[model samples]
Target: MPRASLWFIRTGLLALAAGFTLGALLLLNKGLPIYPGLWRLLPAHIELLLVGWTLNLALGVAYWILPRFIRGAPRGPGWPVWAAYGLLNVGVILACVEPWVASGPWLASVGRALEALAAGFFAVHAWPRVKPHGV
Candidate 1:
């Protein structure tokens, strides 16, 4: 509906596509004997799909859905919306790409931190939703 909502929905859909595509790749890795380190690739694939796809999608949808949970408009959606979107997407991308390209422990760690920060934003932003829903 809104730009923020669109961001969330797009991110959710991207995450889904990532999961399915990456899952298939992972399966292909295991299936193809020519693919070296296929076994090792499996773990990264799983993490990418799980966190990158599933968790991110869930977060985005939550972000999109959160407006309804709060009173009024929610301070215009909070500053963390951008941070969450940027950090989560960047982190997941780095987490997925860096491991394959070059030394990425730092990138991965930063990515992890970013993702955590995104989660923190979600927690803070969605705090109002935590209360008894039926009340």
Candidate 2:
């Protein structure tokens, strides 16, 4: 597997952990009323688990398993992958913390924008790899 794939998988795992932790805290808050504003984190939890964990892991696996170019290369140039990685991680971080920060709305907007751009880059990088089998 490529180093980029490994990084994506590992970071996805981290996102899973964070999502679970946040979920647990939310559940505890429901029963114990410990955290007054816990509901505000619901969006972050969903984003972490779905986008950060699931989507990221899927992308990583796709990057690893997808067919290569005619030259037997695993994928295209590395810069876009790296950019995706950076944008995804940074976006998720910013988005996750947005709920608690004073500049939350701004952060969330920027984060979402970054994530969208990252997805575009990922699609662009991976699209060429999709091909009919036994070509």
Candidate No. with top lDDT: 2
C-alpha lDDT of all candidate models, in order: 0.68, 0.87
lDDT of 2 by residue, 29-130 (tens): 999898688898888898899889997898889888888776655577877888888998888888888878899989999999999889988888888889
Candidate 1, residues 1-135, lDDT tens digits: the string is 546647766775776676677678767777775567555555456666778667766766766655354456643465677777777778777676655766777777887888888888767777766555433
For model 2, the stretches where C-alpha displacement exceeds 4 angstroms are 133-135
Cα-based lDDT at residue 4, candidate 1? 60
Q: State every prediction's TM-score relative to the real structure.
A: 0.76, 0.91
RMSD to native for every prediction? 3.0, 1.5
* Winning candidate number (TM-score): 2
Pick out the ten consecutive residues of candidate 1 with the lowest summed lDDT: 67-76
